[model samples]
Target chain A: MSSCGVLVVAGTHGNEVNAPWLLQQWQANPDLIDAAGLAVQKVIGNPEALRRRCRYVDRDLNRCFLPEQLEQGASGLEFQRAGELLRLHGPSGEQPCAVAIDLHSTTAAMGNSLVVYGRRPADLALAALVQGALGLPIYLHEADAQQTGFLVESWPCGLVIEVGPVPQGLLNAGVVEQTRLGLESCLRALYQVRQELARLPDALVVHRHLGSRDLPKAENGEPQALVHPELQGRDWQNIASTQAMFRAADGTDRCEAWVGGEIPVFVNEAAYAEKSIAFSLTRREVWPVEPNWLLALKQLLAAA
Target chain B: MSSCGVLVVAGTHGNEVNAPWLLQQWQANPDLIDAAGLAVQKVIGNPEALRRRCRYVDRDLNRCFLPEQLEQGASGLEFQRAGELLRLHGPSGEQPCAVAIDLHSTTAAMGNSLVVYGRRPADLALAALVQGALGLPIYLHEADAQQTGFLVESWPCGLVIEVGPVPQGLLNAGVVEQTRLGLESCLRALYQVRQELARLPDALVVHRHLGSRDLPKAENGEPQALVHPELQGRDWQNIASTQAMFRAADGTDRCEAWVGGEIPVFVNEAAYAEKSIAFSLTRREVWPVEPNWLLALKQLLAAA
Candidate 1:
């Protein structure tokens, strides 16, 4: 990579419409977006899926990003698309993307969050810059290895911008605006980092991954409870052991917490229901911040 | 027909989970629901669709209630299901539903609304009772003859309890509580009607249906405009002709209203995107009401 550039991917899942729509809108009016010092390569991840107005045709494209999966030449439509994405935007590309940013929307109440796969210094630094700019939470989800096959994992420096509560295949003007603001902010941060004017506060707060809780289901697989009234729409809030989670069908049994002191993320997410996951829990972890991190990280990423 | 009975239907669309879940909860604990003076029969509309967690397997079940479709013996999955629904809860069933109330949730910011299909005396009286009890908007959508195949149309006294902005196949606890409250209020109104203690005002206001505006679309059919910033979440508000409706992708052309004095309903509705509708416009109409309308209507409905 000559100096520094970024690849922004959207609609990694076909159902997410906001990010790709934002990119399309911005591209249609390029002057409308200010990307002062960045070489931006925008790609809609799965066009076919988007056209069908469904999540995916075969397998989820986001889950097709594993290194081995790309190398082994899998036969699924998403696997083939994964190879194409790898060739076009992966690190091994002729003009590799110095940084990759995936845009996503959720049916969850996770309001404009930055997701980091790991605590890699570069990723954390970039996330810190954006977080510092937006004051949004950084969800450090590193534990679920099964979910490691994310689009951003293909690049050395990458992060995911997850915004909601927008449903799949639907566009909310507010969500579209938020996505644009986020992309603009990310581009501005990139410009600042390229100009060596970016700094990290040596310490940061992150919601570290714990695990996900599943909604109560019956033996035949129907949900047996409703999300507790108290915890509904209370995403990103800390809960105690005494907090009610779900109200049983019988109304006599209310499911309360066995474990406390954990903050719930993706609470009552609509998409996760297909996967049988209710919501993921995270515990906040504060780490000492490092200074001049973005510049250093950019230099490191460029050389990679 | 029974002297006083009510049929509450949920999951008319399989994807809408909250209402069905509410019914399930009520069924599991019948005593939890307050219907002391009423005989309530709760039914989940589309079980197969609900099991698959989809809106509909064949067609929208809610749109299969046309009298001609039922008489013609339509063959689609939803059409067959419509026949089944008619036999079970429709007006000509062995044990016909006295008052049919379909519970639905939307992907729009429609806070809580009661939808009446026509201005039949009984239907209007029932709606007026519920409107008085809950103080929610009564949307009188009678113009769209094509979209008139609603489940509520299957009975003489019927209406839809529509609540939002919740996603399909997802349950929001707050929405569930709202659904329950709406149902309870409906039930209370039924009980009052049954006891001949119901009263309706001499006048009422309704948001009369006008028409729908489609989002600007590109040649390949992607939305080319955003719901104007000014009208993003301002649902149920009257817009002047000077007000912007959609902001074009090029940002130079803002689509302003050509008509004024109309109120927009389901503004920025997520589901409408798939159907090429941006938002629906309604004009409020006030009509003269008669005294002791509920009791007279109840007697009329009972003899029907």
Candidate 2:
């Protein structure tokens, strides 16, 4: 078998410091990896950014992973870093990463969520196993032109472990500890799949991603409104059409509310503020696990 | 009397968005002041940084207000901005500000507190009034060479209205609303002192600044540990000698415990992590307000 294993990536956004800190701890104590002998490789996605205690040196590293962006090979900090990461750990690389798990924390109140870029069978299987065990709400993000080039898309089987309510560049013990538990669930899923003991639940819960909306901006693009006080920190919850979503600094309702039957995600994400995305909406669903998902996961794990 | 008033400064760190957002709200609706006609000059301390959604461009704008730093303002974004602010609102400037109330927020669980540079009677009187009315804790910062050059120090009388448990660049409704109340308290104190209707409590509660300690770091200055889980959000509370103040990523305790009786402030403050200050220690005290404190406040408010 080729040198393949589960790859755990942290520091994708350098300012999200908790997971990186946990990675270091896991390094010092190999026992923390209770994955039943699965080869787990941990790496910091943006070492330079982590050193500076900021999100990125030039551009967002997570967003720099698209094929077109990588093909250009222009000299930018995150651009170069992305090429280097793929060169070392891409599917065709010498030390191939079978399944990559990108760890992230957000200012949004998204408590231990999994983000699958598309409904890829392998990605779904992994997310399903973790969600089955941990009851994590999987955010199926797809068809968003503005938000493409996610890190997990490069790997044959990968998903994002997004934890939060933790601030950037600040460590919250509960967020860190809770995130570790979620990661452990991922590892256990991987180990079980390798041993053919994997049992993903019949139904996989997902929050189907809808397009996001930016905070209302003025002529100069300065935000005229922020996420309304009422909707702030109310991520993953269903909202009525009448619910206030955006309020001007003067406390005036300046933007349209979310349509009823849609759940809000990434509400007031600190990083998304720069991207102008106040929040993304989603529709919750419980879909039966497809047989192709388990087959893909088995094939991926068998490779490792 | 000079052209004096309470200069309410926000966006001093830029990433502290709630206060600036509130300041903008207050500007649009002047009725929020409720200060009985106390002139409150609201301004974004670092407008450029606010636009970038970061802290500062060159140096920390809040730390660029020293006598020497201002004199040598050959050129830098914040350096020039500091000179400009002084030219506009300095004691000797066109719009002489009597009491400058700097607004700030932290990632730490500091709640609503007051930070006085040193024990100036004017500062104490203001703190006393607010503390008496609101029961807010005061952090008396002094004699720390490591932390010099503050925006409030530029004015003859000023204090920072530091609020928190809020993350940087993320606005929490509770934090934003509560902070506005704190600013109102400051404005009301000025108005009360001006009309000679101020009656500060007999005792003024203070957390006397002692010193700060950083998280255990590796040789290259990368932190080896974060604020321990137990002590993570216990700001302004006494820490025991045996308390685990810091723990390595792997959940290993690796830092010295606090020496008991010393209260911690700015616990895991995101901004202070760069300055190597995980948390600053303070000794809690309840001191009787001196008669001169009210007199000093009267003079400052009367001038405004």
DockQ of each: 0.44, 0.50
Superposed model 1: Cα runs more than 4 Å off: A1-5, A69-75, A238-243, A248-261, A291-296, B1-5, B35-41, B238-243, B248-255, B258-261, B291-296
TM-score of 1: 0.90
Candidate 2's C-alpha runs over 4 A off are A72-75, A239-242, A248-258, B32-35, B68-80, B238-242, B254-257
Which one wins on lDDT?
2
Query: What lDDT is reached at residue A174 by model 1?
Result: 72
Backbone clashes under 3 angstroms, per model: 5, 1
Candidate 2 structure quality by residue, lDDT tens digits, B76-137: 89889989989988887777788899999988888888999998999999999989889898
lDDT of 1 at B72: 92
What TM-score does chain A reach in every model? 0.94, 0.96
Residue-level lDDT of model 2, residues A1-304, one tens digit each, is 2245777899999888889888887777777657557667788999999988789999999998889868977679998998888888877765788899999999899998999998899999999999889899889998888877888889889999999888898877778877788889998888788778999899998999888988777687757677787898788887878887777644567657567679989988888877878889899999999999999989977775
